[model samples]
Target: MRSYSSYVLIAVATLLVTCHALHKCPGIPGIPGLPGRDGLKGQIHLPGLLGPPGSLIGRPGRHGLPWLQGLPDSLDTERHDVLVNLKHRLSRLEGVLALNGKIREVGDKILASNGREVDFASALQSCEEAGGTIATPKNEEENKAILGIVKQYNRYAYLGIKEGQTSGQFMYINGTPLNYTKWHQYEPNGKGMEKCVEMYTDGSWNDKKCNVNRLTICEF
Candidate 1:
């Protein structure tokens, strides 16, 4: 009877060992779970912010496109305003000069005399201070214009010409050679001794001594 009991006990122990090896405790439910695949991408959408009112172009009461806001105008309005103001001022200047009649405009050049008689140096200083130069005629029309003033005052006026280092050769105050001249016959006879020039009432020019007082005529 004791031997039979021992055999039964051994069989039970062998069966328990085989069952424990075959079955696991499920590893604590695999910690969490297997990683899931990524989801599909979503569509892009832009968020709007408060902006300025839209323009009424192409549609009444409708705003302009957001991207076109604050754009510059096609026309330069500031430049236009400046031009208009300049033209208005010029017209007023023309009217005033006409009324005074002391100044004469020939083409774009304006010739005027202040009725003051002074030496060449003083005359040059006066004209330059007033933003002009002693009357320098470059053509027949300009010479005639200066002549009118000379005749008006009935006095000879100093011309803006000087004897060059070459003696009888004359030039403008800035050292440019004379492009036009109305020298009186047998005039310019003083040579280097008469460095300054004066205009006669007959629209002719004569070289004269610089110290002699002559009419103060200026050209602008």
Candidate 2:
């Protein structure tokens, strides 16, 4: 009986070896296991580049302080007295200037003449050299004053009025518009041709050629 059992076990072992050599006895597959946990987070290498600068500006500064004190009362009184004294001195000086036959005072204006006849250009130069300008009347009183000088010289005198850019439009040498005028009847007919103005013996104004000889009357 022992020999028989031993022979059967040897037969079984030989069969298992033959199956493995022929690769015919593969094991049965098992069921899959559960999923694994997530891995650790990655480490940062370097920080991101710096952001651009801000565009906002600063606020405005505060206002300055006000003035402290006022002027003294005695200063006001002194100013008034000084102005009165200056006006009196000016009146005396005007009187002295009028005492001479060459200077005539009408109102606050002083009209004078070199009593010489010259063209309009020469008259302007002569008056400017004397620290005065050609006589320009702003009113009838001033006009009469200039007319007196013209009558005294017994010749026509060039006034400070002239034709402007437009014909028949007159202005002062300083480019101010005419505030007063004494245009004679049917006068200023030359239009653009007669640029200079002259005072007649009758104390009226007429537009005349600049080259004409006229008395050099100046005003201060």
Candidate 3:
């Protein structure tokens, strides 16, 4: 019984010692786990503030193509020229109308169809002012036409025909020969030193003084 008691005491001491050693020892480190699987990607961030102004600027864009040319006007250059010429002719016609009391156009010739009575010298001046000469008949038809125009006033009219260098011989004011004449019987007998010619209402002509006043005629 004493031996049994001794064994029990020894076992108890051994158990106590083992329990104390276990309590004092440090714990073993565990193996690091594989890095945790990457978490879901985060949201995108906002843009940063603008940087400082640049030193150099880009070149200007090419100038826009020149504006398309406008279409030409209805009156082209040639038509414009014609219009200007017509305007000039109209202005001239207006001037002619103002100068002559009445005018008649006879196949490219403009004549004073009607005129007031004035002295021969004054009549010549008026004709010159109107850019014409005294009435000068070129043929029998023209003489008849002139007589018809002047006879309406029922008066003798001075003619452009006058005595040439030779007395009693007549010629036109333009120095042309007077190839035609219709004289009343026994008239123009070189009476009173007559130098100019006058046409009667009856279409006859006679020598007369230049100072005589009568209805006038002008031709151009």
Candidate 4:
């Protein structure tokens, strides 16, 4: 009986030690679970209270640059008046130039196309004063040009042709032989009486008294 009792005691002690070791040992890790469906959206938060009113609305910012100085009103007015006067002066100058241009045009036309009428002696003197001579046509072109001026007057005009040293022969004022003649029919009838020649409105040459007043052309 005593030996059976000892065997039972030993079996109980061994079983208790085995139970204590199992309680202290680590266990195998388990696999993680699948991700859960997205949680319901979080609630929205309300805006925070407004900050205290900013620094009692600070003083206005300073100007970046100084204001520009300006001319006095009186000086500005004076300058404006001076500009107006200058414009008027310029306009007057333009008008004077226009008048001068007109006068020059008329003078050129007269010099090219016509001459004034005067006594034969005055005509000769005028030609001399103007640095020209009494016109003497030496060819058909010159005759026609002189005749154009004489026809405008529609009257007798003095020519430079006159009796030469030989009584009946005619010559130019400059002593050139009168190579061209346009005498009218039945003209030069005065043998030694007529000393000068004149052109009629018809452009024909005729003997005339030297002192006669007539239109004249000066040639340069």
Q: Which number leads on lDDT?
A: 1
Compared with the true structure, model 3 gives a TM-score of 0.54
- Model 1: lDDT of residue 169: 89
Residue pairs clashing in model 1 are 54-63, 54-64, 55-64
| Candidate closer to the true structure by lDDT (higher is better), 2 or 4 | 2
Encode model 2's per-residue lDDT on 151-199: one tens digit a residue. 8778999999999999999999999999999999998999699999999
What is the C-alpha lDDT profile of model 1 across 1-220, one tens digit per residue?
A: 4475565555445434544576522212223334568543432222232233332222222356553334234334767888999999988897798678878999898888889999999999999999999999999999999999999999999999999898898999999989999999998899689999999999999999999999999988
The TM-score values for the models, in the order shown, are 0.63, 0.58, 0.54, 0.48
Cα-lDDT of candidate 1? 0.80
Question: Tell me, what's the RMSD of every candidate?
Answer: 28.9, 36.3, 43.4, 43.3
Better structure of 1 and 2 per TM-score: 1
Q: Which rank order by TM-score, best down to worst?
A: 1, 2, 3, 4
In model 2, where do residues sit more than 4 Å from their true spots?
Answer: 1-97
Question: For every model in order, what is the number of clashing pairs?
Answer: 3, 0, 0, 0
1-220 in candidate 4: lDDT tens per residue? 4485565555445434554566532223335445578644433222222212221222322432222234466766899999999999967875674455311112222222235667768888887787777777776667676776677667678888888767677888878788889999988876767878988877889988787778867766
Error of 4 at 88 (Å): 30
Cα lDDT of all candidates, in order? 0.80, 0.79, 0.68, 0.64
